[model samples]
Target: MSNGPAGHVARSTVRPNYETGRRGPIRTFLRSADGILIDSVYDPGAVVYGSAENPADAGRSPTRDLVFVVAHGFTGDVDRPHVRRVAGRLRAHGAVVTFSFRGHGRSGGRSTVGDKEVLDLAAAVEWARGLGHVRVATVGFSMGGSVVLRHAALHSGTVDAVVSVSAPARWYYRGTAPMRRLHWLVTRPEGRLVGRYGLRTRIHHRDWDPVPLSPAEAVPRIAPAPLLIVHGDRDGYFPLDHPRMLAEAAGDHGELWVEAGMGHAENAADDGLLSRIGRWAAVKAG
Candidate 1:
């Protein structure tokens, strides 16, 4: 019940400036786990060593460390630079495998925000687990962060750890004057009308859910397994306190990273930030 409907947490935001690098093509594969045919894709340009072609090459070695399952934000595809950057970073650290969430890229199903997406995350984890990886961690950006939190909360003892960047706990809240003004201006009558029937609708898929899955509500349950909440002090959509509130809601169960000038998921490569998360996951999974 941490970041749930009854939770009280102030919202905040930072300046909005996003940039991503040109990504190479994706390596597609169809793998079945728990009866779900997960459409997994990876950056071929990011391939460090070994070949995904040989089934043995894909299998994790007994000495293999940990595998990271990367999830991207809303309206994000696997080809996005942010996704690629994170995957590239993890791969450089020798992550076993990485892939996008269901319905985001070549994956199947309609976006359910964090609702059904949690199941997709579970499937992805099960896929990695089946591959002989001893420990697993998930890194999610924006909406994907919420999905990761929900998955961790539900499967607390199962997952090793979780990291959420620029993920909002309360969907509706005002943290700063500019953020409040922007929220009112953008979510007002015109915004509502547009979202309802306009050309640029926020919820596009027919299966989109109106109810936002409050990850804060799920954070408390993600204990035992470490959780890392990373957010930009300069995020535009959600405020800084959103992450703070999520951290507080998580009690002593998790750690938080409040970067000074980071924005949403689409920022430059912050190897330090990613390294901190990587270390945290490595320690937790170990």
Candidate 2:
């Protein structure tokens, strides 16, 4: 690991008996629209056991032909355990690119919550495409979920498929305790201070100059490119109506899955669920 300007860090590892002759996962910083240096990592999928039923040539096929760009939720970065786990599971289906949004982890700038996050996701998606992957799918959770939806809508034809989990359909929702607390966390100076110190996330102290499009409004423009909306039935944040509204806006092009007994975002996503999502993205990209 080596550190660079503006809190950027690059990390890679060497493996023995390497056949691909490629270096370890590439880690670097990408510049967002507003000049924020977004920390990112790209992992070229290695051969892994495909399925229990197929043993002979199961691990021979590599998933590097496709790419999945993963965007994490609020306060989550590429290095977080849950984020790493999500990336690991998706590697079975394709190459994985994960990034830390502005104001999170080592990335510079303050979070506009989800308002300006579309640029962050856009940067990551662009970086993924630059890596020579023919197909790219974006998967995001919570705030990052909203970011992916808006990014896909704003930059048409940039992504092949999109998966948004536990995202709010509209903004300014405070129906639940967590949402209420989150609003407090993003709306007040004290809250921003707490977020910066306690959560390691820096919340911008100003309101959106011109409020961005809501996720529900953005979903309509994402057609032709497949979309998957996954929300937990028991989610404490935004409830099922959020996903329902988003899916409804997406019409025939969108698929909705309301997982029972699940909660919120990436931390609540199990390995089985992640694998299923990865496979779904790979199939959709095909």
Candidate 3:
């Protein structure tokens, strides 16, 4: 966005417009910058790119050159029902791109949790670009939500807009019961066993060589790029402070929405909320 807060990258911010239709999904496996194989799916919208010969048809569509790149939560993959539902709802606003994180589903490599998963998201965003999309809006949930924030900070000029749903502001938090249990899964042998066998998520054993940037820290760097931080008052893993901290760091550059009676992540996101997110991403990216 604005030279990465004075001397970070000096790259110019990207502002775009968007419009949408729908077709079958095209599945593909792509390689990340780190040589990991990522399982990805592309859902084409109603009108093909460059297919609207008549001006009226083009005017009728609102998401012609836009794409929504969805990043799922921990333990989620491309085939998950919640993820599918999100893609289905977002198709009405633009084309959708969903992919498995490194250690989830058909993707290859162990999960680094939120650290290395940024590479996975980078791969998916690149894949969307190769599909002829000019506008890219990243929509992430939970752990994926944190990843998107870091990705936007590290890979500026790639994403037109960002929507982080239910993300944590900092790292190593153990206040919540679910978060305590999650730390166990990532730090203990038996818990890792359960994660592999029960949750089907293969977690890496090594700790972060050097701790990466936190979501709150990344927020300040995303200035001039539209960011929407959505949170629920009833999230089990993270409390309202998580989103609030992020909003504070984002200052005037980001918008925060505290949904009434909402819970957590993709499992808790309803069709109505998803529709609003889709429409918001379209307008912001455009």
Candidate 4:
């Protein structure tokens, strides 16, 4: 790994290992449709076998069979420990690709928060496809949850499956302390400054030119490709109604799991829950 712009860690790109019939880890920057450079990493999965290993490694498959592209929440990047933990868990099922949305890490441009982030995810998914994975699944958290919903709707049939966690059903105004503070964090100059210095997230000064599609509206369009909505019943950001709305919109094509004691997004998702999600992705992609 080498130091990238603004003193962020950046990994070097490596060629795929053809001899092993697997791809090597590749670290590179991807260009969003709007031209923002997104910092990304592709990790090949570790080899695993059934209880008894056969001469041909019977139940084992190559690392590139499926790829999970992880999209993190607001104020999150590919390098965050929580994000890394999530990626590490998914690696048990298949290859993992994680990237920092623009303005979050070494990626260029300011964040419009969630709007236009679809372009960033699109770029990452396109890159994952180019890596030659047989299947691709998108796993997103919080702000990224909203992004993945919009992305799957916007680019129908592009991804094989999608998992959204702790996403809002619509543009919400909860009057809750966390949601209120979060609004302030994105809407005010002082909050933006704190975000830049304290959180290392740069907020864009401008608002959406044309308001982007909301998660509720997007969910109805995500059919044909599998959708899984995972939210915490005790989530501080959004409540049970949010996931219910999304699942209702999704109709038969979507599945909802409201964890009993979970809180919110990546920080709240435990190892066992993440393992279950990884396994679900592996099955859906298969």
Top candidate by lDDT: 4
TM-score for each of the candidates:
0.69, 0.89, 0.88, 0.91
Q: Candidate 3 residues 107-195, lDDT tens each?
A: 88999999999988988887787657889999999999999999999998889999999999999999999999999999999998999
Off-target runs (Cα >4 Å) in candidate 3 are 1-24, 47-64
Model 4, position 66: C-alpha lDDT score:
85
Q: Rank the candidates by TM-score, best first.
A: 4, 2, 3, 1
lDDT of 4 by residue, 140-198 (tens): 99999999999999999889999999998888455568998988988899999999999
| Superior candidate under lDDT, 1 versus 4 | 4
Alpha-carbon local distance difference test for all models: 0.63, 0.86, 0.86, 0.87
lDDT of 1 by residue, 1-286 (tens): 1231210111212211223232232343333232323345432223333466765556333224477877777656666676766776766543534554544555554444456667666765665664445788888888788888988877666678788888888765676574476454344666435433432223324433556458888898888888888888878778777898899999887888888888776453387787777767877775
The model with the greater TM-score, 1 or 2, is 2
Off by over 4 Å in 2: 1-23, 48-64
Worst 10 residues of 1 by lDDT: 4-13
lDDT score at residue 209, model 2, on the 0-100 scale: 79
**In candidate 2, how many Å is residue 163 off?**
0.2
